[model samples]
Target: MDKSGNMIDKMLTQNGLVYKIPNKVAAKQGPAFLQKQRSGSVAYTQGVAAEQQACHWLEQDGWTVLLRRARTHRGEIDIVASKAAVLCFVEVKKRRSIEEALVSLQPAQQRRLFRAAECLLQKHPYWQYEEMRFDLFVFDNAGKMERLEDILRQM
Candidate 1:
């Protein structure tokens, strides 16, 4: 059981699924579904990798990570972190530039973030904190984190 878990863990760690290529020859024949399928697969893999990195970064900074890739009816919160007395809900954007990163967040995305946070609060009322806020994490194409901004404080 431990060995199976370890194998799954290794397969899950990093964006290992991104390397999986679809049958391009099959795609060319008719529907071209393989291309879209591969793209979606890669996206899911990248999202997992980004979530893992965000959790690791928060933990390194001394915050206890509560969750990663937390989902609600509205949308997903990439990371949930707590320390001292604050609960931070995070959205991670991975891009090639700062502009691209910021552009990734739209008004609809903000609404989803708020709804997800509210859902979390409802579920975990015992998790007391002096404050709660939504945060944005920007990661460059090289997998380096460039910025972390608290969007809640601004609003």
Candidate 2:
């Protein structure tokens, strides 16, 4: 309908209906703000869904999950759980395959997770937990979860 012969688009707003220029122009002219917003929303939702799945699996295994998305200056621990008398700091990595998930936690990530566990211990002095362990939950592309090694003493 415009001079370029492309159909003009309309978007609804609380104020009223308004015309929106085609996305090609803005995407080509400057930063893709809309795309970034959409991508961020998608990533956040995916993370939450994965955490929920991990929590469900942990509960089914008789672990009392205390917290999720636990963050510190070091990094974010996906889930914190207590089983028997031990405290567990968990790192969850989701990938398309077992090999991908195994390789997901690089050396740098391991260091961050280590620091986060120390921070957790510092925060909860009353925990008096006899054992502390770092565990990894690997989720495949189909959303199947499996427990890998408990990399506590390895540190």
Best by TM-score: 1
Using lDDT as the measure, the top candidate is 2
> Which 10 residues in a row give candidate 1 its minimum summed lDDT?
1-10
**For residue 37, what is the lDDT in candidate 1?**
80
TM-score of each: 0.74, 0.72
Cα lDDT of all candidates, in order?
A: 0.76, 0.78
Candidate 1: which pairs clash?
none
Query: What is the C-alpha lDDT profile of model 1 across 11-88, one tens digit per residue?
Result: 233555534444444434443565678878987787678778888888898989998888888788888999899899
| Model 2 CA deviation exceeding 4 Å by range | 1-40, 152-155
RMSD of 2: 5.9
